[model samples]
Target chain A: MSQILVEALAKTYRVAERAPGLSGALSGLVRRRWREVHALAGVSFSLEAGELLAFIGPNGAGKSTTVKILSGILRPTSGRVEVGGLVPYEDRIRHVARIGVVFGQRSQLWWDLPVLDGFDLLADIYRVEPARYRKRRDELVSMLRLEPLLAQPVRQLSLGQRMRAEFAAALLHDPQILFLDEPTIGLDAPSKLAVREFVRRLNREQGVTVLLTTHDMHDVEALAERVIVIGHGRVLTDSPFASLRSGVFAERRLHVDFAGPAPEITMPGVTVRSRDEGSLELAFNPADIPAPQLIAAITAQHAVDDIHVDEVAIEEVIARFYDLHDAREA
Target chain B: MAPLRPYLAAFRARFQLLLEYRVAALAGFATQLWWGGIRIMVFAAFYGAHAAAAPISLADAITYVWLGQALLALQPWSADPEIGHAVRTGGVGYDSLRPLDAYGFWYARSLGWMLARALPRAVLMVLFAGFVLPLVGLGEWAWRPPSSLEAALLFIPAFVLMAALAAAVLMLANIVVAATLNERGVNSILTPVVIVFSGSMLPLNFYPKAWQSWLHLQPLAGIVDVPFRIYFADLHGGAALQGLALQAGWTLVLVAIGRLAMARMMRRLEMQGG
Candidate 1:
């Protein structure tokens, strides 16, 4: 059986609506209108143990809603969600004990307490035995480079520092599954890399099942083995990262810097994307004509200064994907 | 022991964090002293007007006023501020992630916040009103000691129950705030109700005779009037036990209601951000 299974999950929210003026506000006091929002519309997916899956979507795409449901924070309107053989919402206490969650926009640590004290409180909250807690605390402290940060109050730490402390706080109990919602949001380049590296190590070395939702495509490229692209509360694609990339756009770009004025390339599968005085850009499908053969055909007839092939940017692919499905936030 | 560890830890951490706000404690003590002085003068005038017809003696009235000021923070004047802030900012979602009973966790923290804020002021009020007034030859106006040895002994458990009852009441307020997603309406309504019914504004005895029994039996009375009455031995013997029972009963009832409300609210909770 899959370690995490969500079948036909649906969550609808009744939002109170009102009109735009004082008269509307006064009338709203007497009678209110409510609109139902379908946050999750029959979404289904499953993850085996130790699998790292990246859940990517635009804003308001129900990514966080799904994570909240799976983590037992919110009960879905209708669905079956089981984590480690326990229904997440029904058996919350038992299920939550086995999963660690970090919502990067929020801090779990007490703002006024020192980082170490917050960790101690979490240790007790999770009821880890004293000796085992000490070992785990020391390991996480060193791993996240939180030793120097232990004495500083959480309010005083920078965003990067606090995020590291949050990661340690969430994992202090050695949970089997970790759910990270936009864990690298608002982080600098180095901090983002550090977060990615730590998550990768935790997933690979510790064999921890990780479900990450992020807008950072680099996070998906670097950490996730499988990707699930969700849009409008529905999973659009679930496959290996490479396959998703290929499936979305198979056309690769080749930029060539010719030794002389660029020559026209008239291949069956290739088209000239752009032509400049001393350079040429061509788009081609590798399946139609292999890169090596195309390169050989080019060099065989013309002098080539430099040539390199590049895949489309991941951000562009996701934007195009969102467009294809009309999944942009309303 | 293991099951209770999380609540205990939450309590201790909040207690320690709140204790660090020494300035707030000092400011509160000063404010309470000002109010205590005004209330004592008002009672002295009222007693002078009808000395023989008064329900209690002026000295006991003075002590009750001092005690009310000293422990005013124990009243469930509003929901826990941290919980209110969490509800507004959507941080309340993080609270549900913990593998513990939600009501118990919040109740522990509320108890800690109340006690920590009340303790220093209580000690300071005792030092000034109990000792300094007597040393300065104004003993009649001072906060007197418990009326008898038995009253002193019973006051201990009463005090503990008072804290529990306050936390329970505050938990209900917190649930309301969570359900409404706004603290202003509940808090504005709660403050006046708590002030009047908790006997902080005036002892229940001072109220009209017809309303006396109902006032004494109400839950907020356990927070102030019952406990303070026990301290003065006014509700002694079987009556004192009744007061303690009232405190305990109300605490349990409020906690039960709070637990139910919290469960219902959490089921429908929708965290509004990604």
Candidate 2:
């Protein structure tokens, strides 16, 4: 079943046009002016039950705006968004109860209160029954390893510690869907890995539908099965993560080391990307010259001691996707 | 049983947060003590020079001053800045997403916090004033003390209603401010207004009749008027109850408007993109 549906999700903002200097500022006071900026333009997508989808885009690409609309905090300028068979904005109180949201930059916890107090308060805010709240809170505490941290005030906890508590707090209601906006943006290396591992387990084992928006390509590579690339307030591409990377920009690098000075072996459909002492890097399109053919070409004329192939990084693939979309639009 | 239960639960959490500030709580009481002392001296200097033939008795005046000082911390306008902060910081997004009613949550939280501050100050002011009143020779060692029996009946409800009224008005004012500006801007404008109109700086009686009449009709004066009238005018029975009713009426009216405005503004808020 489709768990989320968004159609033509457009949001435009009327921003006050303030002038550059004192004279313009004085003039603006007499006659205020506004210019409309379309934050999202006809965005549309759908997610099936228990799907792990990574929503990625550059800054100001409407990633957070989409999340906000879906979570019921924002009403779209014109669009239809149905989560769990209800319009999120119209039935916000009912719809929001079933989903949880976590923003990496902000915390939902009361800063002066202990972590347990915050979780307990959330239990009340979500109207979770005492018995159910207790059971779920305990489960989340254990899952997030928040036992020791629960007694400390939210302000007292370190960022990593606080983030774990935040994740647990959002889930204490046992929300069916989790919307994480850059959940691991500024964490240290180990903390980032821990969050990634936890998210992976939550999606695979628990079947909790996860829609995560992030700048980190590694997070997408580590957790998301499908990727939705949005840019300029539109979804440019949506496909399986692996296929999206492989389908576009198929240039792969093959580095071969020879026992002697590298031979300039030239072949059709194969171009030398770079070369170093006793090693050469060749770029080739698999459609024209397959990896095996390229390897054969190198081995045919050169005494190759070692060799390895590197596919394009996902970041490069996404950048190329952006360039391709921009070029077509232009 | 349905929505009320969760609101109560949230209120309990809010209460806990309000009382967690031990040092601020103590400092709050100390400041009330200082103000009480200074205001009592003002009354002393007046009674000391003039012949004691005024309609407002020295005893009643003394009690009024002390309670007014004590009640300053309990006034409802406390929640306005919080609303402003929420609006300014974009934290209102998370709050709006919660299943609770935005106005009710803030109103309850403000009431809880006022109780936290007010309860302590009330105790210390009564105790310290009890000690100092005699030394100053202000009547029979008690400034209109209702005996132990009347204390049980009138003062508890009086303070509670006062706090609730204050919270409601403050929350309403905050909703208006939140719709337009952030907390810092609201605080800058609203604090002086609260100080002037609520009679925190001086009792409404001290103001001219027209000013007093205007302030009395407002939500601010409504919060402070009942407690002041009950303590100073020696009003009881129907009149005192009516004062309490006015406080209740204002609280209900303001809270209703606040809730409606909050719901409307929350709908219009574009927190994520803005």
Candidate 3:
């Protein structure tokens, strides 16, 4: 059985609506109008133990809503969600004990308390035995390089520092599964790499199942083995990262820096994407013409100074996929 | 022990954090002193005008005023500000992630905040009003000790129950804030109601005689008038036990209601933003 299973999940929210002025406000007070928003519409997915999956989509795509439901924070309107043989929302307290969650935009630590104090509070909250807690606390502290940060209050830490602390806080109980919602949002390049590295190690070395929702394509490329692209409250694609990339856009690019003025390419399966002073950017489908064949064709006809072949960036691939499905934010 | 650890840890952490605000405690003590003085003078004037017809002696009224001033923070003046902020910012979602009962977690923290703010001021008020006034040749105006040994003994449990009742009431206010997504409406309504019915503004006995029984039985009365009256032996013996029972009963009732409301609200809680 899958460690986490969500089938035909649906959630609807009733939002009160009002008009634009004081009169509208007064009329709203007398009689209100409510509109229903379907945050999740029959979404389904399942994950095995130790699987690392990335949920990616544009804004308002219901990724976070799904994470909330799986973590037992929000009850789905209609669905069957089971984690480790227990329904998430029904057996919330027990289910939560087995999973860790980090919402990057929110801090679980008390703002006024030192980082270590927050850890101690969490240890007690989880009711970890004192001896086991000490070992776990020390391990996380050293793993996250939180020794110097232990004494500083959470409000004083920089965003990167606080995010590290949040990761440690979530993992102190040694949960079997971890949920990260935009965990690298607003982080710098180095911080993003660090977060990715830590998550990878936790998943690979410790064998903890990871379900992450992120907008950073690099996060998906570096960490996730499987990718689920969700939009319009439904899963658009779920496959291996390599397959998703190829399935979305098979076109690869070859940039050739010719020794002289760039020659126009008049190939059957290739097109000139851009012409620069001394370089030509050519796009081709590897299935139609292999990269080596295309590179050989370009060099044979022209004196090539520098030549390289590269796949399209993941961001562009995802954007094109969304466009193909018309899944841009409404 | 294991089951209660989370709530106890929450309570201890909040209590310790709040106690660190020494300057806020000093400022609150000063404000309470000023108000206590004004209320004492008003009572003295009223007693002078109606010495024979008053329900209680002026000395007892003075003691009542001082107790009210000292423990003024014990009143459920507003929902816990932290809970209010969390509800507004969508941080309350974190509370749901914890492997603990949400109501018990919040109740522990609220109890901690109330006691930490009240204890220091109560100690300071006792030293100044109960000791300094008598030393400075103002014996008649000083906050007197409990009327008898038994009164003093009974006041201990009464005081503990008072804190429990206040925390329970504050939990209801917090649920309202969470449900409505705004604290201002509930706070404005709660503050005045707590003030008048708790007898922080005036003695419950001083209210119209016809309303005295109703006022004495109300929940807020356990927070202020019942306990303070117990300290002065006005509600002694069987009356004191009844007052304690009223405090216990109200705490249980409010806690049950709060738990139900919290469960219902959380079922449909829609965190505001991504």
Candidate 4:
């Protein structure tokens, strides 16, 4: 059974539009103007138990909007959204107790309270049993390395340290599904790695389903096997990372360092993409020119000291997808 | 019992949190003291002017002023600015997800803050009034604990109903302000209205006859004025019981209205996405 299901779920906001200056403000009060912004346009997706999917998009791409709707925070304007067999907006309290949400930019911990105090308060809020709460809290604290920070007031902790506390707070109830919205944002290198590692283990070892939305491509690359890209209130692509890479840019680069000055290497199937001095970079589809044939031809033609092949960057692949999406819209 | 347990725990936690900020609580109490002290002086001035042909004894007027000052500290009709803060900051979304009821959680927290603010202020007002009022010939005022029968029958219920009504009225105001401005400025503007109608600044007795009648009908008057009239003055008969009933009735009605408004607003709520 699917852990989360959303079908044709749409949400539109009636936003007040105002011009600048005092006269405009007075006119707005007398006769206000509103523009409808379609935040989510028939967005539909489903997730299975223990599935870790990255929901990626550009700014204002309805990523957090979808997360809020799924987590029972905001009601969708139209269509159906079911998580764990319950309509999220209608059964908000029941649904929320079963799902954990961690927003990287905001700490859920109480400002004046110690980290443990916030966790204990959450235990009360969720009505978790004392024994189970203690066990889960201890496990999450250890996994997130929050023992040292547990006694400190939340306001006293650094952003990275506080993010660890937030993770522990969200998991204190032992929720089955986790929605992470930019959970590793603003973290240092070590903290980011720790968070990624923990999220990976949580999904793989504990069978906790995860739906993560982030601007950090590295987070998607490190954790999510499957990526779902959305733009302008629509899903652009949903596929495994490898499939995306291979399908978008299958051609690889071959960097050749010649023993002497290299000659201009120009072939029908292969072309020199970049070069400087003795080193030459080549690009060609593998189907058109086999790597072995290309290498042999290069070696035969020039004295090569070293050679290496590189895949296209994931950022470039996503940029191409965005350009395609925009062109279609235009 | 099941539903009430969560509220009880929340109430306790809220009380603990409020108590931790002892210095802030003391400062809030001091501010209340300054206001009450000024009102008490105003009463003494009035007594001095009318001493020659005093309609009521100087002691009675002094007692009435002091009781009004004390009860004003316990007035629950003040809005919590945090509700607006929570909504604007997107924290209210998480609050809505708690398993406990939203109205009960806020009510309990507000009650906890009232006690934190009121208890110290009551003590300070009593001490300060005792020292200052008598020197100005406001006459002797004694700690006349309500006679046993009156205590058992009148004061307890009157106090409870009055506080509940104040809290409920403030809560309704909170909902309206939260919906309109997503801020608590509406309540700030209405504070003077509460003071005038609730007889916190002076006894409702001093107001014009028609205005007094209208003020009596308001929820604010039931909170402090009616209770003050019963306890501080030697008002005859079951006026205390009747006023208590009126206060309780208003509390129930306001609470129901506030809850309905909150539910509707929450359904249409939108949080800023960052």
Candidate 5:
């Protein structure tokens, strides 16, 4: 059975409307107007146990709305949501107790208290038994390598340190499902890798079902096996990360460094995207021409010193995919 | 056991957070001291001129001022800014994620804040006014301990109940602020009204006979008037029980209102895509 099942979920936000300028502001005071913003328009998805699903969307695309509903922090305008066989909003307290959530931009730890103290407080909040709490707390601390920073106040910890602490805090109860919203956002390269690796192990080893939402495509590429692309509050595409990369934008990027001057040689399938003094970049659809043929053609033209080929950056693929999704809807 | 661990932990956490900012409490104490000094002088002069005409003896009036100063931290109004900031900045989303009931969690925290700052300042002020200030020659303007042991016995329970009511009322106001999201209106409207009407600015007895009776019926009177009357021997057994009943009634009423408001606001927050 699926650990999380959401069917035909919809959420509408009643937003207060006001005209611009002084008169509009004053008129709003007496008689306020409102407009409805449909955050989610009948979204549906399911996550089997131990699945790592990356939910990708643009701003206000309802990624957070869905996550909130699934985490039991939000009530849907309509439709159904269940986590661990419990209706999230209807059985909010019970549903939430079984799932852990981490919003990247928010820290759950108390700012003035030491990191360990925040952990203790969370242990209490989750009602973890004292002996179990101590054991779990120490295990997470050592796993996260949080020993050195345990005594320092949360305010004093670096953002990277704080994020790690947040991860440990959210896991203190050993939640069956983890919902991470932009968990790697605003992190340095190393920190991002650390978080992604931790998430990967948590899913693979502990079998914790994860629903991740992020704008960072690297995070999606590195962590999520399946990607759910959302735009305008609708699921645009749901497929494996590899297929999504090639399905919309089928081109692979090739970088060639010549032994001498780069030649302006034209090939049937490959198109040069950029050229410099001794190196040239090309894009070619592998469907039309295989990568080996393209490389052979390049070697035949130029005295090659070094060559490399990479799939089009996932970020660009997503941007183009969003454009396709948006155009289709329009 | 249903497990008091979570609420107790939240309370302890909140107390520790307030403990980090004792400077704020100290600043509050100094401000209250200055205000108390001025009120005491004004009341002492009035009672000296017309002792028979005064509504309370000079001792009771001065005691009221000092108690007001010490207990100012316990008011529902002063903590509104913190709750406002949390809601406006969207930080309260984390709070909503916790497993505990939102109303009980915050109520415990509010009480923790009261105990952290208000309780200590109260002890200090009572000691200084009862012993130090009187020996230093402000005899009638200093605190007079409860007249009989019976009064202290009555005041303790009343004081505890009043604090619980204040916590509930403050939590209710915070839920209103969260639901409304009108920080400026609450700041400009709610705070001033609470400060003026809570009898924190001036004791209700100072008002005319007709106004005093109804003013005692207000929620803030349970916060201030009930405790002071018990300590000052101005209230006996029946009246003391009545004061306790008023606080208990308000506590029950506000707890109900607060829980309902919190549930409604939580749904509203969810609908708003919190």
Candidate 6:
């Protein structure tokens, strides 16, 4: 059985609607109107133990709502979930004891207290033994290179520094599963890379199941073996990273850095995206013309040097996918 | 009994957080002293003329004002702003994921903040009013202990507990307002109530004979009046014990209600969008 199991999960929120303007506001006080919003229509997935899955989606695509439900924070309007053979919301305390969650935008540490003090408080809260807690804190502090920051107040730490502390704080209890909600958001490139590396090690070495939701495509490529693409509160695609990239966006890019000034070249199916002094980029759907065929056709016309081929960026793929989805819905 | 270590750790953490803002505490001390002086001038005028006709003597009245000023931090004037903001911004989502019970955790922390705010201020205010002011020949205006220092000191534990409970009750109430009414509504609902009934403005007797009984039994009265009355030996042995019992009773009831409300509010809790 998978460590995390969710099926046909759905959630709707009842948001109060206030009329605009002074007259609308006055009438709203007498009797407010409410509109039901379906945050999750039907999101279903299962996570096997030791799996690192990246859940990707556009904003308001229910990525968070889905994560919240799985973490036992929000109740689903409909569907079933069994995380570690326990219904998270129903068995909250016991379930929460076994799972760690890091919300990138929120810090669990006391803002005014030193980072070490917050760790100690969390240790008490999680009921971690003194010996084990010390060992774990030392290990994580060194792992994240947080020893120099141990005595600093959290409010004084930079966003990157705080997130590192947050990661250690979440893991102090030695939870079997970790949920990272946009863990790399707003991080500098090196910080993002460090976080990705840490999460990869945590998943691979410790066999810790990680469900990472992020918008940074590089994070997905670096850490996740499988990617789950969600849109409109439903699973649009789920497969191995390589397969998902090809399946959802069969388009690929070819960059030819010429020996000198680049030549303007276009095939029947290929579109020239940009041209620079010594290079040009092309976008082509694999279905329109196989990448090899396009390359061969390209070499037939101009001298090719330092040629590179890559898939379309995940952001662009998702954007075009959403445009297709919205167009279909409209 | 529940292991108190976790609660104690929370308490210590909260205390440390409050102490970090030492400048604010100093400002608070100055503000309370200023208020103390004004109350003295006004009450001295009222009592200097009618000392014979008053129920509480001039000395007791002045003591009441000083003690109220010193112990002012103990009142549940507002919800624990951190937890309240967390709930408002949905930061509470991560907060609720913690293993601790929200009620006990917040209660312990809130009590910790109050004690941190109160302990030093209370000591300094008492020393300044009782010792420094009197040394300057202001004894008539300074705070004085009642006939028995031992008895007054003895009742302090009960008063502090009562005040902490009142704070918890008020903090819990603000959650309901914050979750439903948002942040503005929290200020609108709580500000007036904290100022009026919490005894910061004036004593219950200052109102009217008709409202005295009800006013004295209020949660704020437990915060200021009951504690000070015990210190003044206004309510002796049996009555003092009864007062402590009543405060404890109210605490249990209010905490229970607060816990249930918290559990219910969190059941469908929502916060800042992920």
Each model's Cα RMSD: 3.3, 3.8, 2.8, 4.3, 2.8, 3.2
DockQ of 6: 0.68
Chain B TM-score list for all models: 0.98, 0.84, 0.98, 0.85, 0.91, 0.91
Q: What is the TM-score, restricted to chain A, for candidate 3?
A: 0.85
Docking class of 5: medium
Rank by lDDT (best first): 3, 1, 5, 6, 2, 4
Per-residue lDDT tens digits for candidate 5, residues A1-330, read 888888999988888999999999999999999998888998999999999999987777789999988887778889988788899878877877888999998888888999999999999889998899899888888878899999999999888999999999999999989999889888998889989989999999999999999988788879988999886678888888888766754688899999998899677877889999999999888988898998898788679999998877655666677777663344
How many steric overlaps does candidate 2 have?
Answer: 2
lDDT per residue for candidate 3 within A105-159, as digits (tens), equals 9999999999999999999999988899999989988888899999999999999
TM-score of 6: 0.91
Model 3 interface DockQ: 0.81
- Number of the top TM-score candidate: 3
lDDT of 5 at A67: 92
Q: After superposition, how far is residue A201 of candidate 2 from its true place, in Å?
A: 2.3
Model 3, residue A330: distance off in Å is 6.9
TM-score of chain B of 3: 0.98
lDDT of 4 by residue, A86-162 (tens): 99888977888899899887767778888888788778777888899889988998898889988898999998888
Kindly report the docking quality category of candidate 1.
medium
- Residue pairs in clash, model 2: B76-B166, B76-B167
- The sequence of per-residue lDDT tens digits that candidate 6 reaches over residues B37-74 is 89888888987797776767778788888988887778
User: What TM-score does chain A of each model score against the native chain A?
Assistant: 0.83, 0.83, 0.85, 0.83, 0.86, 0.86
User: What TM-score quantifies how close candidate 4 is to the native fold?
Assistant: 0.86
Tell me the DockQ of each model, to 2 decimals: 0.79, 0.61, 0.81, 0.45, 0.63, 0.68
Winner of 2 and 3 under DockQ: 3
Per-residue accuracy of model 1 over A216-255 as CA lDDT, tens digit each: 8889989998999887788878899888766665778899
Off by over 4 Å in 5: A18-34, A255-268, A272-281, A285-296, A299-315, A323-330, B270-274
Which candidate comes out best when scored by DockQ? Answer: 3
Q: How accurate is candidate 3 locally (lDDT)?
A: 0.92
Fill in the DockQ of model 2: 0.61
Q: Write the per-residue lDDT of candidate 5 for residues B1-274, one digit (tens) a residue.
A: 3477889998899888887776786776777778888988888777778899877677788888887888877877755555777787777777767787887887887788777878767777777777889899978678788878989899898889878988887787777778777666555666777777777777677677878777988877888877878878787789888888988898888899889888888877843442
